[model samples]
Target: MTITIERTRTAPQPTRQQPAADPKPATGSFQTVQPDLEVTAPLGERYDEILTPEALAFLARLHDRFAHTRHELLAVRLQTRVDAANGRDPKFLPETEWIRNDTTWRVAGAGPGLEDRRVEITGPTDRKMAINALNSGAKVWLADHEDATSPTWANVVEGQLSLFDFLRGNLEYTSPEGKEYRVTASETPTIVFRPRGWHLVEKHLKFHDRAGRAMHASGSLVDFGLYFFHNAKALIEGGRGPYFYLPKLESHREAKLWNDIFTFAEEELGIPHGTIRATVLIETIQAAFQMDEILYELRDHCAGLNAGRWDYIFSIVKTFRSRGRRWVMPDRKQITMTVPFMRAYTELLVQTCHKRGAHAIGGMSAFIPNRRDPEVTERALAAVSADKRREAGDGFDGTWVAHPDLIPTARAEFDAVLGERPNQVDRLRDDVQVTAAQLLDIPSGSGEVTEAGVYDNVSICIRYIESWLRGTGAAAIDNLMEDAATAEISRSQVWQWLHDNTVTAEGTRIDQTSIVRIMAAAVADLPRFEGDRFDDAISVFRSVALEPEFPTFLTVGAYARFL
Candidate 1:
């Protein structure tokens, strides 16, 4: 059935079940939790293939065993942030110093289909993008269900279905303009799926706990559970194990939680232990200091680490945006991979991952090629080429690109580095010595916050939020790929600049009055459509960017209200 979403075309929602009212809490173990959990979203065609009873039961089991731990870790994150905000600054952990000092341990290096991740195209797992990614000639496809996807119930459910169909060799798509495309390629890229981060919840699925209390299901469990439950065996049979890109983890404890989940999932499904491989994104400030411990905790199943640069910057702001002008940063474009602070982070990451036999993947540049403008495309290619070359030369085994157009450029850079080899993990980069001060150096970069920077942040944040509220998470704006991660940095910078009372190079002070004028101009400049959500976007931007207290994530609040 065609469901009427507030879009130009119909978007299908998931198939829901109105289970009998069961207010009773669950007993010990997952049996009780699985039966009482309810799927509240309405249904659509072929939804049963993904939302089967078995899948929900598996999902509930994951929640049952690990939900409390997830909550506790989230609490630790809040306290840690609070501590930073209150002048309790962070340093390398004294307690886990043993893990860092011990240099003998190593992660179970690249599994099949993951060895040569030289050029990975990162995007949402929607049909069109999935097909483009698979056929993009990249070595790996970061099948993203996290920031790149709008977490509508349809997107959540259909993403699994799309991956399932692609794995089964039956996936295809046709444009509304009557062009048909099949998911065929000379060699499909290795698929590494990214589940949502731990901080959010899947409100559509309500779980009743032992206390007889109903709460939202864990988004991580829902996304990972459905995907793993349905396709683990098939993936193993097809020469690829179930791989994951874990996002926004704050500590080694969180890594241990995922390691435990992987172990349990392998056993429950009769797969051999260590069949699951995960590459954790060191997005948050806390996780940056725990790289060695994180790899150690997941050594049995760990594959590598990725420098989630956009969120890393946003994480820094969220942690210390309210402190003072000393912690205040410059424009977003100014913080490149070569910056002293970012260089320390990436160097330390490479050192830690290489010491433990894991791939060090670089971050995406976000400068996607604009096809309509040849000069813009040329400039984007140059920018992306420079970015990828820096990573390739700096001892990274692989890197990520947002658009398929940049795959050749990224691969060329890595190809020049690793001509006949799959990766350079053996290059331990032991000469790279980093300290806590270098990693947390807030005053290193040199750039001024200009009026142009302020306008860019406000307009980009509003434009991105509008697209997201319209059910499109990823969009092209100003010759770059703008997703939830980039949007977070954009809005956070606006908030950070305004909160710190930043003055531009022209001596223009960033205050509520200036922000309002900029936001009004941004909204008015957009091409108005009948179903646009600019109003809601403005409200979301206002709440997250201009509010007194920071919301941990912009998507969490906007998703609750709009999606």
Candidate 2:
């Protein structure tokens, strides 16, 4: 069952970014200031409210001040990958060991409305979802603009508008059928926004520094700046600050970068320092080894750490893909949280966070409830409950749920462990000891690449990629909340299987041709309703999964080429 495909790979090249000798950027808010910043995308309805001249200028300032550091960190990420390929694997920084051992230093701990995060509902910030999430009886609402929502220009601006309305008590939605949605919860979940990662660029916005240079803006700064500038003061006045969830960070240096941005933003906005609290997602393997240092770097403005499971798996695959069979993973389904390596990662996260008086949040369980089928919903809830229970028993203070209905089940598990306490941050798992080798121990997991797993990977890659292309980043496929992180795992698994020449449990050789056939069948199974972009999705899956060289992220190349 070998496919007649080119099995050769061109080695990955080093990606280095050097600062321009002079950078020019400005956004004229009035007649006095020249409009040095340009908007490349068309203005959508209500965009003016979010993209006011003053906000644009503030965003421009942030870009100019921090863009170079973002680029340097990104380059370091690539070099780290290249170094791993050459046998220099990621390890704890010797220079930062002092920070790791300094037991007296502690993070700012939890901010207002963030003390108890037992059940956090994660979704996009569209008017409807925002209301529903607010009404949902969860402790926090992760108003996600990152992987959960596609970064279409309209979405970016409108998302800000939604958040603005939410903060001002002005959010109201009426469906075409005249049904109304409102934030009815007496105590709505606290909002913690998740911006796009540093690797991404907001191409629609162009910045010209005072030094007269033009370049695309960093998506991180753009999202953070607009939201922080417009909402920070309001949030502070409302007794909540501009809290955030920092994603895809690879090193402690990147944590320092975020800490600097937080300082600058607070000073610029006239808000007090340490007002902005951030929860860093320990998704990358490199970051797992530097948890203590990451918390130390942002101690003044840090909340806690989250175990982003899917992206963590994808990161492992991306960082160690060129290392051959020892690094190859089996079916994505087989990499459960209880697996030894995953156990090590999560246990270590809980241990590190509790040791520093920070919350240890658990990862997302893709098993979402099904509304149409009572039987399916029952099974899904059971699965989600079990996963949440494990996290709670293992010392996690909170967990993530994609759908609102699953909130109770997750809450119950946490309540069972948490009792009347606000959180279990005091439960420091001192007994948990994890080594780098344990964290990197992929072979210990029990699983294999079955033929069914290969086809499942192909089908998910095609379906999820199509959903993303159609401007819905979070898609419910096969009864799970599929997002960019899960899609990365799906596609990268195929690439990994092909790269390692893995054989299914039934002894079939997995290859590109077989995957192509499986993808076609998957597409055939999906109803090609009007406006659906199946063809485009297939092409994206092919490009990302079948390429000779592995893409660091599935979204980066796709976003750069299209949208």
Candidate 3:
């Protein structure tokens, strides 16, 4: 099957507007004073009165290591090379510049045609089930590795290696009819893989080559990209394609790093650079902040970014846990592409990418249930339809479906959404002429920073907690936390800072004085949650100390005395 790229006139175009002059970087002497207000400790004398000495010491060690991890050495090297090659300053394009000057960028807009794109996952016994799903007109088939797969490390290694075997027609399996079935090399539904997370699960996938040398050298970054590279030949030869859904990306740097790796793989393996497509999950709060950068970094190789709902929610809560009551729990339903900020973010993403002539695909409709419940399926289909309607209205080219059962429903909904003619009359509306700059510049409480022009204090506090949890460094800034809603921005900043400062798993030169100040302030002002009673203070302190900037002397001393 030949994949055709269609150019639609209904594609979004930039509205007419006067472009503003480029913004000059802020200068002049600004007051550098930290906020000086003081409050009594909510926990009173009991605040520092919680954990055992050993726990406190462990926390200190953990914090020290996290604050000093070398997370971005390779990324820095690659970036330096790219910058030197381009012979340009490496300063990132400002968000405002991207919004105002980039007129060619189009937001994801409704298209007239919708190619039915549904994905189904098949297992060892369910090859026929998968083929049936594909025959039913599903556009994509994602072979599982993370969730739907139950393969152990050995099996995973074997399965991956056997992929080439099957694709090459060297391997055959017996069908239910007692006949041998062989895979014919032919283009079919787009095949993609959802691999295991890098942190915990990737270790299990290992394969040795014919020379008794490991195909993936242990602890090599090449291990991550090589698996795909080695199989590229088989994939293309077998009539499938090369594509992947990358998970657990922490920031744009990660995306860019992957892009560089992919570039290397393509060049080394003699495959076309754009042939292999990648869809990164903007799951973590940090990933969201760097969405534009990430997209831009991987623009040529990227299919699109997916809004991972559950992981994203978990990221938000984890990032802002220190903000206590001030942090609002995001309503999952309301917080999707429909929510104001999210809508703006998604719209901005669409606009930025489309302006550059890239696809702005929507994320998953995770509400779809199993095939066993027709009522649930009906409701899910309705929800999918509503979501597609919204996405169509907003101009998204495509969306994702989590379950195989929902593939048909999702494809149908998208098809229905695409069938409608672009309302030329609607295009003539005043709102249609409003530039993205104006839309983004619509003043709201969400943009407020402190006098320091940093994020709000609560937001900073939340970021501190999150960074600490992740074993990263912390700094207090009043304005950084105002819009705690976009946890990605806050978390990414912390990660960037950690990366820049050479934070490692080993200890760093932490500012003990700054730590004391932050601890005293947090202990004084922040309210204790339930279970943060006197008895829990030691435990909490120990946990918090494990953060990058835990008040080492004070925490250690307190724990020793308490124990």
Candidate 4:
């Protein structure tokens, strides 16, 4: 499990100031902008380790250099949507055809701990959960700072603290019930940090431009900067460098932005070039078409691609919600990975990744087993097994599960195919010949809208949003690990249904008015909670879900409400 520098690429280094000429901070990186860093959020005791002056300076440097580009890329995202609305939808980029056609290039293959990721469990980075996940018997723990995490100041700071302890083999926790949880050497998973996506802003931290205008730093940069600044050397010493799961990238340009950030950070920290590895989440429809170029842009640092199913569905609905009924999707349950579009998406992912000698990781099975109910647990396991069997059989190197209880089942499925193998990267999936039409084919009769579906959507979203407001992002509801992505899917599907003015199977017509009623009733039925975030959550949900214009992500607006 040593850090793998064997396949590390040697490229022309970026020009930087000599250590003697630069002001040496505690992190040993030169400070570019020394503007006063402000933390507006509540600072808990012991957060100093994560938000040290040197770390804040590192974050400020990253923001000063790349925050403008992040803004520009967001604008580009809006413009892409506008162009799609005007009949210039995203397609295979002719300009980047050379990158896709050239088969000679391959990404830096799997790094040390990531070489075998047959089953990666994902969860928020609370101390207890962090300890449990690292010992969950999964190959990798997606230490999530994104959808599975609510951006409360305490959670953010404490999560960083947990990761700091994890790398040093000192992660420990004792529950209120006196249950002790600690990392074990016998079953430790590789840690892959999933920062917030590019769309989010860290309101707690503020930076000023040269013009003296204050602005919030990009959440992605903050999470990435703080983690790399604090733990790059520690993780490397632990036989792994900083690894990331980049989510919701829409194009190769975004991926290139990430690559540039990686390069800059590596040089700034004096780490080896290509010491960082990333797995891009192909969660957006636009990114699906640009997988080849994304990998190409980060080839020197890319590890693979992931099939992020729920958010991918949310993207499809959000991107094409105004296109009339032709692209209107059915119930979420019916649009499982076996559907035409999803199958094409997964097949294309495996084909593209294996073609370029990268690992092709499958989507998440978010079912948290019901330990008290044997029948429910068995059924969940059966479904998860089938999903992994399909993925492993179809040439995927690994798959994801949200709960540790299902890890043995998922691992067994992959073990059937990857016996004595770290990964199936050599399984090139030459048989997957997918075309644009095949990938975009909206399946007919996927599922009918029903009264049950409508109510469930409202209920699940309200439930999730309430927990999110209370500082928990991953909520166990109905035996499923529901995160912001699931809430997105729930709300977006309802919006799509309302947009299409579709009638349910049981003759219930879904309208904005009806949805509002359902939302009200859903909230009213819930037991009294301690806070008013339920009201705020419902307000945000209604605006994003029922409005004429769809917001990019529910968390963006909802985050501002609480965090």
Off by over 4 Å in 4: 1-36
Candidates 1 and 4, the one with greater lDDT: 1
> Taking the tens digit of each residue's C-alpha lDDT, what string does model 4 give over 1-563?
11111110122222342112123333434233234346776667777778876677677668767888999999999998888766666688899999989989999978888999999999999998888788788898999999999998788889999998877767899999999987875958888899999999888877754344578878899899888888999989988879999999999999999999999999899999999999999999999999999999999899999999999988888888777787788777778888888898999999999989888999999998887999999998999999999999999999999988899999999999999999999887788888887777875437777777888888898889888988999999889999999899899889889988988898878897888788777877876656646777778778878888788888888888767
Candidate 4: residue pairs that collide: none
Deviation in angstroms for 176 in model 2?
A: 3.8
Among these predicted structures, which one has the highest TM-score?
Answer: 1
lDDT, candidates in the order shown: 0.86, 0.85, 0.42, 0.85
Higher-scoring candidate on lDDT, 2 or 3: 2
Total backbone clashes of candidate 1, pairs 3 or more residues apart or in separate chains: 3
Q: Residue-wise lDDT of candidate 2 within 453-502, one digit each (tens)? A: 88888888778877877778888888898999998998888988887788
Give candidates' CA RMSD values in order.
Answer: 5.8, 8.6, 20.6, 6.6
Q: Which ten contiguous residues of candidate 1 have the minimum total lDDT?
A: 2-11
What lDDT score goes with residue 41 in model 1? 84
Q: Against the true structure, whose lDDT is highest?
A: 1
- Compose the digit string of candidate 1's lDDT tens values, residues 373-458: 99978977888889888899989999998888888888999999999999999998979999989988979888889888888888
The per-residue C-alpha lDDT of model 1 at residue 342 equals: 92
What's the lDDT for residue 17 in model 1? 22
Ranking by lDDT: 1, 2, 4, 3
